[model samples]
Target chain A: MNHNLFPGFIGLSAALFAIGAVGVLVRRNPIVVFMCIELMLNAGNLALIAFGRFTHTMDGQVFALIVITVAASEVVVGLALITGVFRSGRGLDVDELSEMRE
Target chain B: MSVIFGLAAAVAVVAALGVVVAQRTLYSALALVANMVALAVLFLTLDAQFLAAVQIIVYAGAVMVLFVFIIALLSPGAQERLHPLEARVLIGGLAAVAFTVVVARLTLNGVSVAASGRFYGRLGPFAPVLVDRHGQVQTLGEQLFTTFLLPFELSSLLLLVAAVGAVYLSRRRRAS
Candidate 1:
């Protein structure tokens, strides 16, 4: 097992992050966008854990745990909002929720 | 180790792309589930056994189930195709690629300069600290209770707030 897998891990994380970013950019459905956001969060978590592994510390793992908690809360709130929007008959399109921009 | 990492990475990348490219939102959620599982495998390979378990139980199991439940509730029948290759998507894709390149470079540079940032401790002799069935979880629990206690308690509070807020927000309003 080669010890130099840091770059590989980082690069893979970046690619996953990019895919997530593009998904958020192009997706119209709020649920899909939210899932993409989760993807981005996972990418960041992966990086933190990898860095923790490299640094011989538990800090990165702790941070990853925190991030996962935050993401779970985010999904809860976000889905609540989505359900509210759906109930209000606004549909799930992100473009239609621009009333706040005024 | 590298082979496991490579295979997991490949699976994760493909599943991530599938999440983005799938036509139906349900399919997208499933793809995200696959991506999350693959990521958990990657976490295992990284020797973060606690994290790997958390990723599987929390993200892959709970979070994805929530997503799939919401998709079922939304029940968007016959998925509408967005105008693929549109100007906005094109620009977004380019920006994403550029961002990835910059972040990748920064990561490599930071790793090279940071103390104890070498590819050590992740595997080999020190691997047992994390990969050991009892040791890693116990260490993580000790740290969670002692060193990281404040944040741990705060996260529980956060979850409480989220639960309350979700219920409040989703409740049906009575006619005034």
Candidate 2:
């Protein structure tokens, strides 16, 4: 078992992050955008875990756990905000929610 | 092992693309589930057994359920045309490519430096031998309770705050 798989994992992580960035940029629906953000966070977690494994440390996994916790909470609050927007009869498109832009 | 890694990576990347390209929100959620599952497999390959389980249970199981439930509840219609040829889309794609190139270069450079034995950073206490003897979960648990205890407790507090905020935000208010 080649323990030196760090570069491959890092490359995959970078690709995933880029894809998530593109999703965030192009997606208009806030929920989808939020999902993109999760994708990006997951990408970061992948990199952290890879680094941890490469260096033989548990810190990376621990940090990844914290990231997961934060992501879960973010999903909760983000979905709630989206739900509120839906209930308020506002357009679901993120662009339409730009009342603060005025 | 490399074969498995390659397959899992392919699945993850394809699923991630599906998440972005799917027109229907439900499909996007499903794609994300697939992507997360593939990532869990990748985690297992990296010797992070505990994270693999957490990734599957928390990400694929709990978080995705919330996304799908919301999609069902709201039933937002499919998005309008994605306009792949639009100028904004083109620019965003270009930017993402540039970002990926820079990150990949940095990662490759760091790994190569580490490989060349130029910098041997201090390794942690949880080496593979110790981890293998004690099991990944036990070692992680010990560290989590001791060294990382503060962040662990802070995360719990953050979760509580998030729960309260979500409830307040979603509460029904009388029409003014």
In the range B1-176, model 1's lDDT, one tens digit per residue, is: 98889899999999998888788999999899889999999998887888999999999889989989988878977575756578987888788889879977987676566436444524432355444645887777787898999999999999999999999999989978
> Scored by CA lDDT, what does every candidate get?
0.86, 0.90
Q: What's the CA error at residue B20 for candidate 1, in Å? A: 1.3
Superposition error at B134 for model 1 (Å)? 6.5
**Tens-digit per-residue lDDT, A1-102, candidate 2:** 464566789889999999999998898988889999999999999999988887888999999999999999999999999999999899789888889999
Candidate achieving the largest lDDT: 2
Over the stretch A1-102, how does candidate 1's per-residue lDDT look in tens digits? 344788788888898999999999888888999999999999999999887777667778888999999999999999999999999888788977899998
Separate DockQ for every predicted complex:
0.62, 0.74
Which model scores highest in TM-score?
2
lDDT of 2 at B83: 79
Off by over 4 Å in 1: B110-134
Q: Write the per-residue lDDT of candidate 2 for residues B1-176, one digit (tens) a residue.
A: 99999999999999998888889898899999999999999999989999999999999999999999999999998575577889988898888778778877887788668777653355667778899999999999998999999999999999999999999999989879
CAPRI category for model 1: medium
